[model samples]
Target: MRRTAAALGATIMLSACAWSNAGLPASADETTEDARDSDVILNMFQWSWTSVAEECGSTIGPAGFGYVQVSPPQEEIQGTEWWTSYQPVSYQIEGKMGTREEFAEMVQKCDEAGVGVIADAVINHTTGADTGAGTGTAGSSYALDDFPGIYGPEHFNDCREDISDYTDRDNVQNCRLSSLQDLATGSEEVQDTLAAYMNDLLDMGVEGFRIDAAKHMPAEDLAAIKSKLSDPDVYWVQEVIGAAGEPIQPSEYTGTGDVHEFDYGRQLKSAFGGSIAGLDSIAEGKLDSEDAGVFVDNHDTERNGETLNYKDGDTYTLANDFMLAYDYGRPSVYTGYTFEDFDAGAPGSTATEVGDASCGAEEWTCTQRLPEIQGMVAFHNAVAGTEVTDWWDDGDNNIAFGRGEKGFAALNNTEGEVTNTYRSSLPAGTYCNMAAGTDCTETVTVAEDGSFEAVVPAKGAVAIDVEHME
Candidate 1:
């Protein structure tokens, strides 16, 4: 039997169905687990099924990641562009990523490694009406609103035009997005088909789903579809990019599952670009930490330049390090191929088939596998359930803080090493500096007085946890 742990869980159910990006409000007498109590997620975007299985056993599982969010596995359009995977033709678990049998085996391998798989479920719409007739990665034929043995024009929406008005709920929810045939999600036939497709993946041992383009579909319709799942309580996170003054927002769907907190990344981008001191209030105006799935940069944001990405080099590393150390929403580290063009495909891949992840290859930037990043994962797991305390920042580029008595971290984003005596909540002991790479050669000592003096290197970070001592 497969062992599964959810990276997404909503303890509070909303009383009012209001559409606000603000998260679930806790009751006066309500008590909930610390937002950071859950484990971290590694979004291995575009990684093949076989490659993901190998990575789970080799790196991800050992690093203590609770889950790995994979790209869409259903049969998708046959194109070299990465977005092609987002355009589905059928519900079969056969595509460039792998065959149905291979996907099952990958799930088993990851389960054995204690890593749960969260599949990217692209159920909002199918092949774009403009793509004409073509074959999918698994040889399924699709054209316009026609998917043989799956869906047809009757299953799609009557709103044939593209979405333009955001404030208008009807237009935003019903209209076609980029000419992709929108599913009649409210209809019984479409809902059943979508549920069956998701149930298929769940039966194969996927612990959750990252509902793609969730904002395009009405929250009520999505909730209905989720109710029909084999395990309605299965972990899921919706990709609802929060936009100001938008009628449909992330909060509207928290009753169903967690929603990605876009503000978290945007704030990280701004703070890293300016001063780390500004990050003190990172969660002030966003979703409550527990109901949010936060990331430094995902596939879309990396291309659209909405947040700091792997290209930002040291800055990106420092930002992610801060995210891991901070007590906030569940964190997910993203890794993928390096590309200069927006529509470029993954490395070692083609229009017909996808490639596997090779860590050291110049084309693939396995950011999650970096020594510093991997060490931070251990630091994150060690400090789980702790609160941020002893916060201190230089008003400019340097900051240091502790997570209760479990861990301490200091980061310097400036060009020169910054030395400072920072207060800590950790007990008196020498601990390994987490950001010191794989060897963990550097150590920091927390004195009986609960204070530590250290020199944080420029454009770098240093972290120490009780579980990882020198």
Candidate 2:
């Protein structure tokens, strides 16, 4: 999702009353009620509204996943490319995912199923193409920087150009990202428009938002816009990619909301790739657990080959298992369609509409359906807020840990199975290995003295939580 810059010589144009209410709720506690208690969020990338609704009723809700981050729901540029969803044609709740009616229905059903919907918002830019005329998926017509009644050329940045330098803060914030038209967020009209769009979603029962390309906008401008939002409690997780020497850092955006921990995925990739012993260092990262939304990989990282995706087979699953079991950040699990071409859209469908998702068919990898992963989700929920204790490592590829008497996990990354006896925090009892679900024959018996013997299979994990105790 990195964007290259071109030039920036224009000053941000703003109206006299651009700043609205300045004292906005900036704490995580101010987020939606569902998000406040959630431990994990599932990123169902590119899944249609109906598909997400079905999964919520069938799998995610029942499995205890807190929320599901759906694809951009707004009307977007008509194209078969996946990135087309990132190019907003209008704020209308109509796009390849489904119609506004269908989206509303999906939200209602998901809410009934005890699952919250977090919309992926593409407010940083509109259509990047210079084509003068086109129709969006929702039948909205547009020409150049004009989005009919929603936005005009004046609402966009005067630069009218792509970002030129990543090292410069002004260029990164003001310039267009990969030719995408940059919005003048400092303008009261732009802030009011974006706030209206977001508030509409909130009014329709949306729980939160994942602000796409948040780093491309100035932090104070983002804060001002957020302040104008009607739902002050809506959860916000910004996509702020920070690296060494980059002037725009994630810390700058933390005041707005939690930022994605990109380094978490990078470190997980390195740990799961060969150095499992290094997993212990994850808690020592610069970002605090309370301020990060962590995941092993995202749609962009998977496409860029920066992090391990479902294509890595068991190794990828193991990484997810570790993320769910470890207590650090609010974990997110990602599942999407697999494709040979990075630019290819989801399976089945055309430029105007996306068909229903057929999980496990035509390169669609529904990793969330895996029993092991589902059990891990339960493990995370069962041990929520519990401190990680009883950390033990074989000083190699084998590791074991307990979560304040609520859960225990042992993972072996080596090529061979490893068995070891360790002290458990759980009360003396027989527990089913959640990794195998209720049908699992393997069970761990903890002694009264809080000791148990575990045999972790090669490249596999054994997880047992209090809820699954037999």
Candidate 3:
């Protein structure tokens, strides 16, 4: 790590303390319990275990992220496409990402770096029936209804046809999704098998699991499966994409763990595309803050147009910055490969291997390393536990707000520069423009009244906090 443990701790604790001067910054010594933890999870989508481990020490740990969400590590159907990561054939800890030994090493290294590793658990289904007989990444031969000693036709749900009705909860839970054979999640044997697979990962230092296709299984079944875990208290974030008229909702599974708030990203898309000033009222459509896991974008939403992607350019960065700065659900920042087509794989991916992440602009989006994104990691921590105050906006694309007296930010999504006098809750000082880095040449001066005039660039932002100053 570039910074010592002391330095990282101090940087993260900057704004997570109690304030007295209305919005005055906390002292460096205020290392409260809240300061030690930040709900920042970097979704290293499609990144190899080696790449994720390397990044944990160098970037993720130093950036103040508490966890790294990786692709499914279990053995999957051999393929070059990105979605293949979701197709599980065995729980052997061998996928295109890495081998079992490499996976264990990544967990240890990331743990030493103070970053927890969360696996994407695909317990809802196995390989698609149409995929036919094929060998998995670990050389395990898999047929649609037969996975050697692991599973057979008896373990699958009786609903053999594709899911045709989402409103009917039985079909959605029992039928196959996209011809992928659904598991009999309710059976005692099936739940035991799933629990054993997850226990193996937990034994290897995996801190949590992202329940892939959670909506396809009943909430009771998921709760029962989790109860069988070695540590049922371990984090579990389920992927329940809540639709308005759909019978299943993300709220139904909160008893087991957190649910990804799809509405948060969808609302971000709507607000950022129109008037970002409306963000102050964004809670109207979202799940309860604590139960929700929020992200600017994810693997599915990026391809499906449900949220913004790297292709959206500067607007995408601004949205991510907003996600970190705002007090909402546990925030996860996503970084993934660059592709012209939806089905394309990461740079050098083959049937049994994927290349290391290069983090270049033209190839991998590497959102975690962007100045506007990484710098905000500190800003988010600095302003933790503070409420949004001193809100100001043009009722359009330009908006500015403060997190009590700890920090402040102004976002402008217009084409040209939007210069304005913004209100803040900070004390008088020359603070660093965190849209740049802490060692940045650009700076902002706050008067005694906590107001400053600055030019927020086109589709850009200007952010400052007590902890990040010139």
- TM-scores of the models, in the given order? 0.91, 0.92, 0.91
Off by over 4 Å in 2: 1-37, 360-362, 438-440
Using TM-score as the yardstick, the better of models 1 and 3 is 1
Query: Candidates' lDDT values, in order?
Result: 0.81, 0.81, 0.83
Question: Per-residue lDDT tens digits of candidate 2, residues 211-244?
Answer: 9999999999889988877655457899999889
Measured by lDDT, the strongest candidate is 3
lDDT of residue 60 for candidate 1: 84
Compared with the true structure, what per-residue lDDT tens digits does model 3 show for residues 232-281? 77777899999889999888998978899999999999888888988988
Q: What is the Cα-based lDDT of residue 279 in candidate 3? A: 92
Model 1 Cα lDDT, one tens digit per residue, 157-240: 899999889889889888988988899999987887787777767777787788999998989999998888767776788999
Residue 197's lDDT in candidate 3: 76
Q: Which residue pairs show collisions in model 2?
A: 5-163, 5-164, 6-163, 6-164
lDDT for position 187 in model 3: 92
